[model samples]
Target: MGSTSARTETCKSTSEREIAALFDRWNQSLQTGDPRKVVANYADRSVLLPTVSNTPRLDAAQKLDYFQHFLENKPFGRIDSRTIEIGCTSAVDAGLYTFTFARTGAVVKARYTYTYKWDGSQWLITSHHSSAMPEK
Candidate 1:
């Protein structure tokens, strides 16, 4: 995962629970096993630092490329710990999580941070950084 800085200002309209729900929705998208559905949660210009891939995906097509292969593994993630920070139009959810791959029956523990923006109508992920736990 790359380095990112979050704004210090607190959110005026968004709640912690709502931010948590956003993570939930993203997790659900992954369960669908569709790259397009997973990419839908992200903005057109979003960045994805994936857990298994070293490439940094910076656009929709690149994200789709990464997910296309990832979806084949049938990944499901569960959050173990999280910290949420909300700004007026942006928010960050950073945490530790675990993923189980149905295809291989493998479990991987990881660290992730998803940054989102409230783009008028809905919250969209602007950046998502994930990496496997170093000690693994």
Candidate 2:
């Protein structure tokens, strides 16, 4: 591979690594009930297609609005895993996650996938899809 291509691969891998870290960070932020911190890793135009809720937003502010609502219930979670697959400037991550609410003490375990794109310099999340596991 050319040096540029190699760099792109490195970038893609780095993004996948960061996605795992971001999940933990985001979950911690959610535990804290702070929307801004929770949404920090997402791109300005990111969309969260959660299998948990009905609210959908087009921008950060709108997304945060959804987070704010979620925070009202003191929602929190932990990401247990993350795996990445990259192609060109696109990357996809699939993993298992768990959530705990301070108020409800409910443990929400689920599977999640995040899609990101390299916007030339930085890796930004373009889409986030999450689905909850059936209660056992």
Candidate 3:
């Protein structure tokens, strides 16, 4: 009788810096002012709880609709503070961010959380939740 040993494999965790940079990539997408470009960052099966919209976006089409309107203001985002957590093939970045609307000159402070998954070739956002801050 022969006994076989069980083997365990360790997954390499993504760096916090890399997770943090994902936000920058998403933000850059916003700079394009093209909803399609913005939506490209998200996975096909993803959720977007937007900062400006009451309705939640559950798919790429819904997300495209939201971003189409949101992008009209020419929004630009900057992170105020964030904490990132890395996993085997997933990561989360959550914190405060400020958005400056070029078209309207409106400044909004919001809290955001973005969860990402590595899809073999690239990282894609799986869930994104954002809401304006309660206090001024």
Candidate 4:
């Protein structure tokens, strides 16, 4: 860890917990509908495979714009991350994501995956891809 943590708490041995905390912030900020804070979690040239639109969003700025556009169609929903798998300095966060529309009262649920890389201290989102659940 590079010791540049102000908002993130880090323990000596388990860095995964620290990294997961950072990811939780990402989820909270997104729930707040603050695209800027969501973008802040991404690296400069991160990639987002937003399956909602079936396109890839490259770069933090573009991803922010994507979030804004994407959020418009599907309102806000509760997001939860239940499981994470890590190896060395890289980790993948996977769990449930949902979008509840305000206009039609439709809720879309999906399993989301976020790939994170620990750059010494800070954990940055690299690739994010989400897919809707099968018709059930």
The best candidate in terms of lDDT: 3
Assess every candidate by TM-score: 0.89, 0.72, 0.91, 0.71
lDDT of each residue in 19-121, candidate 2, tens digit only = 4655566666777668888777688878897756876666888778778877876876666877878777777878888877777787789888887777777
The clash numbers for all candidates, in the given order, read: 0, 1, 0, 0
What is the lDDT, from 0 to 100, of the residue 121 in candidate 3?
78
> Mind giving the per-residue lDDT tens digits that candidate 4 earns over 27-67?
66667667787788887767888857676889776788888
Candidate models: Cα lDDT each: 0.91, 0.73, 0.92, 0.73
Worst 10 residues of 2 by lDDT: 4-13
lDDT of 2 at 77: 64
Q: Put down candidate 1 lDDT per residue, 1-136, tens digits, no spaces.
A: 9989985654449899999999889889988988999999999888999988999999999999999999898888899999999888999999999999999999999999999998888999999999999994
For TM-score, candidate 1 versus 2, the one ahead is 1
In the predicted model 2, the residue pairs found to clash are: 77-99
Model 4: lowest-lDDT 10 consecutive positions: 7-16
Model 4 segments beyond 4 Å from truth? 1-20, 73-81, 101-104
Per-residue lDDT of 84 in model 3:
87
Model 4, clash count? 0
Which candidate, 2 or 3, would have the higher lDDT against the true structure?
Answer: 3
